[model samples]
Target chain A: MHYIEVQKKDFNVGYEYQQLVKDNSSDGAVVFFVGRMREFNQGQKVSALTLEHYPGMTEKLLAKIEAEAQERWPLEDSLIIHRYGRMEPGEQIVLVVTASAHRKAAFEACEFLIDWLKTKAPFWKSEETAEGTKWVEAKASDDQAADKWSEK
Target chain B: MITVLFFASLKEQLGCNGISLSGAGINTINDIKQSLIADKPDWSKWLHKPNLLCAKNCEVVNGDCSVTSGDEVAFFPPVTGG
Candidate 1:
């Protein structure tokens, strides 16, 4: 099974982990990633963050990223859950789970999914800092990370 | 008509989220940008910034991307989410 979701409500990490593991008994490895809002970014002290996305495009691009992961790995299933709207520091913002028969495929796929999502996804973030609200800018390091996957 | 969307800093700078451009003579994303700049000369400074990113429909694309009558094209700053 493959699933993708973009929601404003918080999700349960344990429950999602169970859902990815329940039916796929044959898969011996399950790798998951959870991203949380940080209190400090780019020398600013962030108290909260508000996330925005292109409504129709966000879901479409997420599904495309998931499909790419499945094609690159020998996997049993994969899942992606990303949240939008206002979130405080330490709150969860994203989750990715990859289930595969072997450890290597699960590990690589999970990393690849997050790396691609960072640069490819349409989500934008604005942080409430000590000075004021500031829009987050994309970093060159992220693009470099995603570029590594294209290498032979 | 072609729908244009703005996001993040671009939305704040543009002072609007979206606009509909009649497809009469426009054929590409760059054409839409030129029309918008022509209407509001004040926007020329940022509208043509080298770092600005765009998308055709929901896919990330370049300024030369073609557009149809009903396509939803987006203009925004580089993606910052993970």
Candidate 2:
């Protein structure tokens, strides 16, 4: 199953997360990754960040990745939440959770979901700094993380 | 005619997200993209870069692929974040 939201309100992702795992009673393991907005990027002090997405295409892309993870790793349930508009420092930007029959499938699939999402989903991050605003570019590490899975 | 769409940085640089162009000989998505870039040299940054990809008819499309009239051709940067 799939759950997705892109909004400005603060989210109780924990409850929604538990619901995903609970809905699939057979699931034995649940794994999640929360992306937080940090205060710094490339030596620049960021007070806030704005995330923008291509609405329909963004949802479509994420759903596709979630489906791929399920097919590759036997995940029973999955939830993905991504926030848009302006977000302050330390705010939660995104969450990826997966539940499966075994710990390995849950963990690997959850990791794979986030990894692929980083490179394949159509969301852009821009920094709001005292100096000015600038869109964030993809990091080499992020590409490496996603590439490793495709290679395997 | 073909509707050529842009997104994010591509839109920012082009100052517009979309345009409708004459598509007489443009039987392929790549042809439409080439026509747009050829008309607006300023968009060279986006068209020539390897980071940019084309979406034909709402799906990621290869550069060599063809498209019929009225197809929507979207150009996007390499995706980042979930």
Candidate 3:
């Protein structure tokens, strides 16, 4: 099973995890990750962040990324829930869950999913800082992180 | 006509979200860019950025990709989502 969601409303991680594991006894290992908004970025104090995305394209690319992960690993199930719109510091921004019969596949696939989503997804962030609002730039480190997966 | 869309900072920089252009001579994504720059000389800097990304009908594509009437083309910067 695979699920992909892009919405403005926040998601409940516990509820999503239960849904992922429900009636699925075959998978022995499950791994999940949650990304949150932080208060500081690039040495500036950020009060809130507004996320914007290409509506139709965002969902399509996310599905493609999840399918790519399934092709590369023996995944029993996976879930990707990413939130957009205005959010305050410490709020959950994204969630990734992966389940497999073995720990290695579960762990690696979970990491791979998030890594690819970071660079491939069509979402941009603008931060509201003490000084003013600023658009977040794509980090080279993030591109490098996503690129590493292609080598393996 | 073809629809040209811009996202995030590009939209703000261009002060426009989308526009429609007659498909007459618009053959490729680059052609659209050229047309846009011709109309608004100030947009050349942002539209011609080296790292600017392009997509056709919601799928990322090269700027040289073929385009035709009724296609939706998008231009944006590198993604920063996770």
DockQ of each: 0.89, 0.68, 0.90
Cα lDDT tens digits, model 2, B1-82, are: 7788887777787899789877877877677767877888887777778888778766787888888777878887776665
Residues forming the 10-long window of minimal summed lDDT in candidate 3 chain A: A15-24
| lDDT score for residue A97 of model 2 | 84
lDDT of 3 at A116: 93
The residue-by-residue lDDT of candidate 3 on B1-82, one tens digit each, is 9999999999999999999999888899999999999999999999999999999999999989999999999999998886
Off by over 4 Å in 2: A21-24
Q: Is candidate 2 or candidate 3 better by TM-score?
A: 3
Best by DockQ: 3
Cα lDDT tens digits, model 2, A1-152, are: 76777676767766886677554678788888888988988898999988877767777888888878877888778888887888898898888888888899989988888888898888888788988888788888988999988965
lDDT of 1 by residue, B1-82 (tens): 9988888899999899989988878988899999999889998987988999898888888778888899998999988886
> What is the C-alpha local distance difference test score of each model?
0.90, 0.81, 0.93
| CA shift of B15, model 2, Å | 0.8
- The local distance difference test score of model 1 is 0.90
Residue A78 in candidate 1 has what lDDT? 89
lDDT at B25, model 3: 83
Global Cα lDDT for candidate 3: 0.93
TM-scores, in order shown?
A: 0.97, 0.91, 0.98
Can you list the residue pairs that collide in candidate 3? none
Best by lDDT: 3
The root-mean-square deviation over C-alpha atoms between each candidate and the true structure, in angstroms, is 1.0, 1.9, 0.8
